[model samples]
Target: MRTHESGRLVQAALAAITAAAAFGVTACGSDDSASSSSSAEKPAATSTPAAESGKITADSANKGKSIKLGSKNFTESIIIADIYGQALQKAGFTVKYDLNLGLEDVANKAVEDGDIDGYPEYTGTALTALLGVDPSDVPKDEDAAYQEAKKLYKSKFGFTALPQTPFTDSNSLGMTKQKAAELGNPKTISDLKGKSQNLTIAASAECFKRTDCALGFRKVYGLKFKKEIKIDVAQRHEVILKKKADLTVPFTTDGAIAANKEVILKDDKQLFPPYNVTFVLSQKAADKLGPAGQKVIETVQKGLTTPVMSELNSRVDLDKEKPEDVAAEYLKDYL
Candidate 1:
């Protein structure tokens, strides 16, 4: 965890590093295993069709010389890094691995310093943590958020995000399926308007005042809670199960939603900015990867969907499977 001051210090360091480095790296991966690293030996891989077309042919570029993949310390981040690393390897690039790169500050600074090529990052994380944008200032819609993030990264940090995946691990309002059906099968946030006053909401103590939380709900969907109860997120589902609260906020990829058979309401009015997973890379690295590497990354992005990512997360968080194994399984059809 980082204090606001520490976070800003990291942002400052990243800005300095980005300015100093002459070469940058891009991330790509999937399937065959490789050891983790801040630096490591090149992993072996077979060429895929994308690489065979000579799109990522070694002779075409030499700035970075090698593609080094980095990932944050979470299961999801490690798995994503593997996916990118494997794809680049199959695309016939000499790839290196750097998993468990700590928090966003550490990871972003590593990228800026040319310690690694690229990594998967969420838009919301970048906006608030890196760009210093307030949560309320984040664009509500996904495309708009991505576009704005791209511009912010380029202008502020000397880098940009690759084309984004369709899946977004964003905040969502959830209720038991039974509860939703009882309310005439409410599918969108707007559907809860009239009935919300009869319901209790469960969230952190300060959520009601946050523009991206209760305040956004009230303004965007006209929601008015009968009671606002401070509840720890881990116990949110339990509260609903015990009939203490009618609604709770859950991450879109939360396993509890499936376990409890809860339905996440659609944010039809786009009150919250969606955090689509994307590859964050510097222009130096992007140029090195050339058209072939870029195509591979975009292909991987096209394959990911909300349900797909949720299931992948469940396999690790709920089933306790190795993220590498899960990612490899998904990559069987990923390209």
Candidate 2:
């Protein structure tokens, strides 16, 4: 398949921030970052000839051994780690956690060093941050992105990029509902072309430099802001809610978007890369766990949808519920 390959050079610089994505993220979860009102079809468990049922019981699936699970330092990552760790435990694997393990760089190193087995990851992050692919080269179609990433991880690091969760946590441009209405109800990024001069934008501090954010607007959509402000992910939504910025970048699954009732602009240009969550397992660990491990991981991925994940995030970000507890509650249904 022909891949978009512009901005290949800028990927080197963006790679650094992609590793240190240690800051908290606010996303609504889905390959679709715009219009949280829509839901993607939930994926079924991974199909492997190793088992008749989609789920494989851990005890029957693998020899008794310990699996070291790791996660980046964020609520969503931690919660996902627990979901996988806890499920592995139920399957009778001696699961140990290296949770809150800094950033994707740290987690990627651990996996490469054989210090851990696997953890959930975003397809775009793994593609750009780990595999050195240009963001423009990333496939916009969710499954295409996953397939491209799967091939790269297997070839580059001898790792397996398992089937991704239906939910994605991609970046989005959002404005107040009123602001969107004032612009004649523009829906897609292309709609903002000539309107950029009237719009003030805000995004993560790195977005100013990252091609995926502000830079993507100019390069991909031909839009340039009248003014741009840098705000941490934690406060980006507030800037939009307060009308201080006409448009702000927020993760598609960010709980704040729902909490603040903001409107997300569609990325009709297909500029941003897919951030669909998937489990990237080392070839060694995957060989050891076999189909049973695939079942465990796929079950977790299959159960999560955009709305379900958003609520899970809300429990941690808004309700102050522990990620572990939230993970436990969500796992009960699948396990």
Candidate 3:
């Protein structure tokens, strides 16, 4: 067995290497295989997408007015909103924040009802969850995928789809370092599909039924586990660490993913939504915030990436760091 000190050193090195040059695994499978994909492995993927379509033009109402920025009830979303609000303020636009606004329905409804002018969302989610697309499955190509969503949003909701950051934070598979090493340097989702039957998984109670979690991954990926242990969302990491499960399904941008350098399995098949947190504004909010809103969103996109966002999330949600202070520190980097 490796010494604890040796393990710690190895983990530290892995974290440093990944932070500088991130990696991803992409497999080609269908929705049916998605839920079962845990049993397979695929080639490691580079996070860069093929190409993004240009932003679509639309009618806007800009008049240098202040806007209320709303965020969903999650650490990362609230952090992004803070970054955005700060950016807007820097650009001479008055900004208000209603942080932790729950899920997209709440945020989208608020915008539509004119309670708030703008918020952030992901492309795949914006299409299916917000716009009601069929299948409710995630898209394979980020750039091409969001274009369909962009059109849907403009035609249906009268909202502007701003530039989407190239960050995908969603449900995914992960393995322990010891397990990874014992498996002889496992790296792709395809590699695990056939092997998952021998391992157990632990996750939030809802994960077992969520399309992106146990369902989508198993259906398309063809992974069959020995067992799945349902635990509270906050207890997932502890369960995994205690060896209750061989791997855990965690959000891609989760702080745990970063702090522990947990190996995120490559989603050879695009099974989960691209929750890149796109900035959006109501038609009226756009008219009022205009260039101000654009600049704020832009700064946030530059400042927040997968690693940085994951770290910030851990600080607030896991470490119990105050949200406002966390936001201030991140904003200082760009402000």
Candidate 4:
């Protein structure tokens, strides 16, 4: 659990002032009079307060309030949590980060137990994982999935589900370009029919049981791979890169796909349900945020299209940048 105070802007302002004072002292001691004069004439640097500089404005109603935000333990979730947390901080709400809270069930419990005020959650995950809805029963349409999840959350947990992002990060089968070429460049999962018999597939342990993954491949596509390897979710791409597996289960918006390190086959049969993200908050927390705070979250998320999110994920997964740093940079456009 990590807590970020709203004092960051205050610290930046102090630093700017200190730098300006040092510049002034240096100008007074300069041997070059003309250079000193030029320096003296130049305006001192200023630090703009986030609320003033950013599209998200501080609301008087949100002052003195704090929101605890959490995320599932994944690159995309961490980055998204940071983005929402930082944006709320700018809007006069003291934002606390309780990130890397493990999987959907863990995050759901955290919010329910008040360990976190809210967190980002995928629509399909809410239905299939938390709500106990079968994968086969999950809605295929993105909006329909979000609405069902939203309705269920409200009735079951008194949670408020915010509008979802444009991107849907559903489960997908991915392979290297070379591997795809060897398989005759199959464009869809159905195309892999007989070829799967010779392929070694890899995925997280749970995926093997889930209807949206290994089970789906066998039941929906009639695929029977030569071997099924249980790997860590984070290592799905690595196994493919190392040629240990011919195919791996990955999220549609995985950074590896964005980097072209792996290519996702189209899910023509739509085995996986829509997994668009939305902020789920406790009713009390939602009331605390009010309309202004809600607007701030919605506004910041507006720019998170699939490609944009993939690139942000790539910055963390491929470029080795910190999630918080990537989020801060992303918020710059809104700011």
User: Which candidate gets the maximum lDDT versus the true structure?
Assistant: 4
| lDDT of model 3, residue 294 | 72
Give the TM-score of each candidate. 0.65, 0.74, 0.69, 0.81
The per-candidate count of clashes, in order, stands at 11, 8, 46, 0
lDDT of 1 at 60: 28
Root-mean-square deviation of Cα positions for candidate 3 versus the true structure, in angstroms = 13.3
Q: Kindly report which residue pairs in candidate 4 clash with one another.
A: none
Predicted model with the maximum TM-score: 4
Per-residue C-alpha lDDT of model 1 across residues 253-309, encoded as one tens digit per residue: 766687778988998887777788889987888887887678777655454666667
> For each candidate, what is the lDDT?
0.69, 0.70, 0.62, 0.75
> What is the per-residue lDDT of model 2 for residues 16-134, given as tens digits with 9 covering 90 to 100?
32221111112212221111111122222222234345444436444456677777655677778777766666555666666666657888898999878887888987887778888
Q: Rank the candidates by lDDT, best first.
A: 4, 2, 1, 3
- The TM-score obtained by model 4 is 0.81
Better candidate number, 2 or 4, judged by TM-score: 4
Which residue window of length 10 is worst by lDDT in model 3?
30-39
